[model samples]
Target: MKIKSFEIFDYESAVTFWKSIEGVTLNESDTKGSISSFLFRNPGLSFVAKDNNEIVGTILCGHNGRAAQIYHLAVSNSHRGQGLGKELVDLSLSKLVEANIPRCNIFVYSNNCVGNKFWLKNGWDDPTTWKVLQKQLDV
Candidate 1:
């Protein structure tokens, strides 16, 4: 398996891989055009893992001026136990560090047991004092 930067050409395979995973949620922001714009805004932070040229894992990472956010981290079921997820995360975090981002955040659904477990086990702290609130704006 080889890990590499995520190019727009990798979108289809990455989306397919993400759709096959249980805990990942896809939304309007996930469209190819949106992703392309995201890549443009924050280059070299997102990545994919491939096995024999087939995309097996992905992580979409970006940052606002203040903090980094990670999204859509998924690995094929067959590739789950091999540390691909952690590797993807580490790569993104390293990029953030280089960019001088002070903190990183990821959103996992409260009900996504596997995802929550993975994050916790990987030393990500879940702070009880904060709640994520959102409002969908009509674009």
Candidate 2:
């Protein structure tokens, strides 16, 4: 398997892979145009793992001038248990470090047992003192 920078060309396969995962939710922000803009803005931060020219994993990472955020980290079921997820994360974090970003965060649904377990086992903490709130704005 080889890891490569994510481009808009990779979107279709990446989205398909994401949709196949149980915990990943697709929304307006994940549209092709939005993801294209994101990749343009963040550049080298996102990545895809391709094996034999097929997308097997992906990580979408970006920073808002302060802290970095990771989204849509998914690996093909066949590729799990091979540390591909960690490799993708480590690569993103390394880029963030190079850019001087201080911290990184990810959102995992409370009901996503598999995802929650992965994050916990990987040393990600759910801060008891903080809660995430959101409001969808009409465009």
Candidate with maximal TM-score: 2
Model 2, global lDDT = 0.93
Q: What is the clash count of model 1? A: 0
Q: What are the lDDT figures for the candidates, one per model? A: 0.93, 0.93
User: Looking at candidate 2, what is the lDDT of residue 36?
Assistant: 96
Cα lDDT of model 1 by residue, 39-132, tens digit: 9999999999999999888999999978999999888889988889999999999999999999999999999999999999999999999999
Worst 10 residues of 2 by lDDT: 112-121
Q: How much does candidate 1 score in TM-score?
A: 0.97
Candidate with top lDDT is 2
- Clash numbers, per candidate: 0, 0
Writing each residue's lDDT as its tens digit, candidate 2 over 1-139 gives: 9999999999998888899988999998999999999999999999999999999999999999899899999988999999999999999999999999999999888998888888899999889999999999896
Candidate 2: deviation at residue 98, Å?
Answer: 0.2
As for candidate 1, its clashing pairs are none
